[model samples]
Target: MITKQSVIGFIGTGVMGKSMARNLQKEGFPLHVYTRTKEKAAELIEHGAVWKNSVQELAASSDVIITMVGYPQDVEEVYFGEAGILENAKEHTYVIDMTTSKPSLAVDIYRKAKEKNIFALDAPVSGGDIGAKNGTLAIMVGGDEDVFQRMMPIFEVLGENIRLQGGAGSGQHTKLANQITIASNMIGVCEAIVYAKKAGLNPEKVLESISTGAAGSFSLSKLGPRMLKGDFAPGFYVKHFIKDMTIALESAKEMGLSTPGLELSLRLYKELAEKGEADSGTQALIKLFE
Candidate 1:
């Protein structure tokens, strides 16, 4: 039996946030949502969500606050900066940031939440926009075990995989690992499909063959097909993925760690963005080569 009294508040509605909030609504949770782009909040509002005029207002009224903004800075601004969650924090607030952002930022926010006696979890997620739309993200969470337990039901609503990595920034760091693997795999899919196109072997057919082999991956199977058809309408914006990569690089440098593969991915994504597909979905990265 879950507590029905908890009202869920969500920030960042561009893609993931919208779907996640809608899922909560479907599960019979009263939802309040705040988005920088107010227009994006329309569909969710139609689904029975109340429009939170601002992050602070959302923070004030909700029992649990979830964030899924685009970048590390956006996460920071919504949670701790002016007009942010902290501006309207009340006792016993549970704040979860599900953005794929820098680990250190997660740590800083966690500490701030603790000082205010609020429960904060750094819970970055995977599974992209498609998953969000379908209510199946993979959540990597870090915080107190009790709080993690408290959030499990909500996690079950939003993600397929709900993992507890460690405390404070562990979720974000784990998400970095997830991003690193994705960077490599996305590049792999792009290269393989590009080669198939050049060879006139039918990129889709080649994908059908290898997608069941050891090279099989979610990217190669789902996103690879999308890339092949040039359907890059933002399953996770290239711009947003690049921002996540930048967060990974910054965190790696701070830890005195080196990631050459991620560096190459950064460069490739930068070039892709430079070619003007940054606003497109991560699959649109293949456009750089086309």
Candidate 2:
């Protein structure tokens, strides 16, 4: 059973991972962190997290391991090889991959981990960097119900809205559904701002009227102002968002789904990336409209 005494190993200390790991530490869990870049884990180290030199070292020592790496390939690298978590983690160690990756990969990880008596879960999260910083992320989990129950304490420490969707890969499937909604919603959000500005209406005032009504959304309320102020910072990277859309699009096609909105959004994001805005925030899509 997981408790405050469980040593939690966290990999990928990027914009979202860093804050999520820090929250786990604040709740008094002993944290061991590893990232490809040592400098990224520096702050966590200074804040009393134990730093491991590699994934193997961290896996061997920790009771529970959490990974928030970029891309499915990175997930495979951290969990598949002889040096990976499945080989190195102690028997029955609970390994959770919170990265938004392909559902099939999550299922593969689950089967390999189960073979070695490891408990694996795909527990991808939403709410972006702000949600990570605030500990209010919506965590969608996929695993055995008993395992999900066992990890509730740890999940509670990291997020407020946590649910076990179904078996292995369900979490990833749910996250893709989330990205699909956001992909289309982002386009609407950008268009609304552009229309208000072009028509000589104060966009801020217009937002005040529409944001609380039927047109309101997280993208409009949280990111709309950032677009207006030219704050194209990386709350979530465009390159990563594009990666997610590509995965979603591929998954949709495999299921015989036609997603015109998703297709359009993907095309626009690719165009933005081609113009060197790949590292910018999703809110930076407003630049295309401008």
Candidate 3:
């Protein structure tokens, strides 16, 4: 039921956020944008998006506010601080956080927003930069069913696969599960290429063979090509991936579960980070073998 007149305030303009916000603009939604560095948001402003003075100002002005920021701490600062979203948004405003963050934080945001008579959803996404650019992200949502249903039209413009997993923090929990798989899968993708090189097989041909079979995955098909091409520019940052793995590990421990593969992946990624590869794209994991 959200129309083009529903002003959208978007905080975060890096990587995927830029494209995601652009898609909303393309859908004719009036957009208000803000980022730490105003220069980073210039592109959106040039494309008819309005610039906001601060998070508080943006929250006060928009009908729906979406945040896709970095790290759990950033999420906390923007939502829980004195002049934050929960403090300034009007009653019944929809606040959707698309950041991959701690589930407990998401639940806390939901509870806090509800106390203010606001509608909130934790909607974490996957599919990376390509998906963001192509408007095909898989959005996992956790919130009231009624609010989710009302937001479906907006979700449709921003993503292809959208699902409501449960209430409050469930979307973040689901995203942590996703990160667990990607952590191990990235290792597998790197190893498969390494093994191919060791055995004197063309890694590209190996990719051709395995990518269509049971070994196929989003990482193998997409990131594998970037690896073969030696393009390590980040579609997703190694540092961010490490943060995700750390969260997943913490959450798993809370549940009294063990994730050995996740543990191994985190160790290796931390090694890469120590090597100063933190800003490089996640496909750079293959460089550990080379």
Query: Best candidate per lDDT, number?
Result: 2
Every model's TM-score? 0.96, 0.99, 0.99
C-alpha local distance difference test of each model:
0.86, 0.95, 0.95
Per-residue lDDT tens digits of candidate 2, residues 117-215? 999999999998999999999999998999999999999988999999999999999999999999999999999999999999999999889989998
Q: Which residue runs of candidate 2 sit more than 4 Å off their true CA positions?
A: none
Task: Estimate, for each residue in 97-196, the C-alpha lDDT of model 1 and write its tens digit.
Answer: 9888878888889898888898999998888778887888889998899999988889998989889999999998999888888988888888898899
lDDT of 1: 0.86
Estimate the overall C-alpha local distance difference test score of candidate 2. Answer: 0.95
Error of 3 at 224 (Å): 0.4
Q: Candidate 3 lDDT, tens digit per residue, 1-290?
A: 58879999999998999999999999899999989999989989999999998999999999999999999999998998878999999999999999999999999999999999999999999999999999999999999999999999889988999999999999999999999999999999999999999999999999999999999999999999999999999888999999999999999999999999999999999999999999999999988878
- Once fitted onto the true fold, the runs of candidate 3 whose alpha carbons sit more than 4 angstroms away are none
Pairwise TM-score winner, candidates 1 and 3: 3
Query: Which clashing pairs does model 2 show?
Result: none
Pairs of colliding residues, candidate 1 = none
Give the C-alpha miss distance for residue 39 in model 3, angstroms: 1.2
Candidate 1 stretches with Cα past 4 Å from truth are none
